[model samples]
Target chain A: MNDPGRRLPSGSEPVPDPADGPTDGPAGGLTGARSSDRTRAAILRAARAHFARHGYERTTIRAVAADAAIDASMVMRYFGSKENLFDAALTIDLRLPDLAAVARDDLPRVLVRHFLDRWEGDPADDALLLLLRSAVTHERAAERMREIFAEQVAPALGEAVDPRRAGLVSAQLLGLALTRYLLRAPGVTALTPDEVTELYAPALAAVLS
Target chain B: MNDPGRRLPSGSEPVPDPADGPTDGPAGGLTGARSSDRTRAAILRAARAHFARHGYERTTIRAVAADAAIDASMVMRYFGSKENLFDAALTIDLRLPDLAAVARDDLPRVLVRHFLDRWEGDPADDALLLLLRSAVTHERAAERMREIFAEQVAPALGEAVDPRRAGLVSAQLLGLALTRYLLRAPGVTALTPDEVTELYAPALAAVLS
Candidate 1:
């Protein structure tokens, strides 16, 4: 589960450009591919914002275009459909710290705090949260979410523990997100970040070791 | 997450009557209330099946009625709308054990084994799993899910834990369900129930005492 009010960690993706212009490129021809890349990023950013707020069923191409300050035709041209746009927007990098670099005892605290910081950050855009919210109903979305975990988390954890345990780590943290943010369950929601770190790190550490 | 191929525990509901009739009721007049109750149960059973197979959106009143061998008009009359039927279908009881009666050292084993058993049991009908599947998109479904955990899980755990960790306990197990069953993540799904108890019970026991 996800909160629309929360955001992705800032600077995680190429900061989406506000304008659709190639003003930074002289003569423009050489920068054509870069300009296209910027436009795509801007569109994905807008799509994440819409999906985060409205979810899969309600978020429309027109709404995303309006937010990106582009035409609906351009939105369709880039993404083909609402479904494609949702998929493209879901791409995320967890930016996990190298577990091999961190001290063994500090591993649990680092893992716990990393997730809390990302999930608890300020409002703007969060693709992973959008995926979490939408994945419950959409099979493709669920697959992509798992792919993100398996590719990023499982391998990252392989450096420190059995890679198999990585899925459990995903489960533990994602479940925490569900209760604290999504379900707004009274118990864990009341705990501060420091308290969460103190309480959950051990549980996660158990999986890590 | 849920597997469509799996079933809820058997005999959890009155088997839907293949024939809708007053054949079993003597004279019909004295069994009016009893007949009505049976009809309600049959509709609910069929509703659960449809919702389970097709999920909340694709599942239709007509389909549920057809499955129950009842008229679509009767389905509308009884449940009012698909939303109402979805709400009614989500009702469940976890049938938690009285934790106060169990010994301290066995509490973690008991709690872990309990959830593993309920989640892993032979399929028939599982309302909680249905709620978990639907709650992702529907606000009301999410509310009901949290309520179920608070009402059943929190108090059951309060008998052993500090009463605060109950929410964490819910988060922990539900997350496990998400991975093992819904997401079918590689790690926990591979573990037998006994292995899950051995690995997770200590983690849970830490929360308990």
Candidate 2:
């Protein structure tokens, strides 16, 4: 448990401390204490909320500390700074399916389907939304969003397609996510996940081929 | 010239004060100077800069007023509120090409070519980027972005394609904007406008057909 005396931020009511509550360590002994794991989880959850809801600039360490019911100093001890926390919070692996393993003729459909599924499965799984939201307003956020797509999603897919064409495929696929997920275009969001997969698969196949 | 009597947030330095320098109005004409035109222009310029740079919430009215060298009260006098100012600032007419005039088989190419041209033409012409950047953190921004696409782009294209199929076009075209322009994915941005037109046109034709 953290030092209990710290005053939290305004507008947030502190829940019963999780360590002292049902999610607590086994009551038998101190050796069962997993305070470190609990603390990390708390910080991550709070950080994600802050980033997703208030964006990067509005999300301060003091605000996050208050939300997590932990000391502000404890947050710094764990994550170093707001930038470090943001880096950790935004570190998500999209886990896109292996396109090379898909049938060549069905590649577009498969890719589209996979992407639609990922998009529809969870609205909250949107790090892109968080990034897009922040990027519009902040230079650092824009730089980071670009860097992640370049370093992570593009390189992995570029391995399957020719490296030269990877950017095109990445652009289309990421664009699908942006329109369908973040923008929530009625035209984009209205499609059933299956319909999206069906319609866009051939397009994906064309890009890959 | 801006009234030096105004107070503004100290932490917001990236926002420049566009309202502060010398003005053409008479010295005693602060209230009735017809300087509202200048004030309105400054507000628009400041709004675009703030919305383009930081998005909605962080781009405070006070920050914009400071940037415009006007008092926050002047912004309220002209635009009513931040939400109204954002609506005015983000308004855009897509002015899509006449797809109906193109040869049937060549429609996709035409569509893709047009999209690529517009998407790449000016990074700042994007109302979508403005919305995306502000949406994650601000619900109003999200709603407005959704409304624009649903009301403007979708209706125009929905007339050409099946209502059901039109959304796919929205998804594809918008996806291009999100990935290529906003996200700045290397693979996405690397494609020449012509290549994108070539690659995407057939798919677009299919949707229409």
Candidate 1 C-alpha lDDT tens digits along A71-185: 9999999999988888787777777888778887887788878888767763323666677776665678778878888888777766657655676778788888777767677
Off by over 4 Å in 1: A1-35, A122-125, B1-5, B8-34, B122-125
For model 2, how does the per-residue alpha-carbon lDDT over A1-209 read when each residue is reduced to its tens digit?
A: 22111111123333322222233556444243355656665776677667767667668999888878899999999899999898776665566676557666766676666655554443334444555555545557767767766676566564656644565566567666656656555666666767667766666556566
Residue B63 lDDT in model 1?
Answer: 81
Candidate 2 has a TM-score of 0.72
lDDT of 1 at B48: 75
List the candidates' TM-scores in order: 0.83, 0.72
Most accurate candidate by lDDT: 1
Interface RMSD of 1: 1.6
Error of model 2, residue A8, in angstroms: 24
RMSD of 1: 5.3
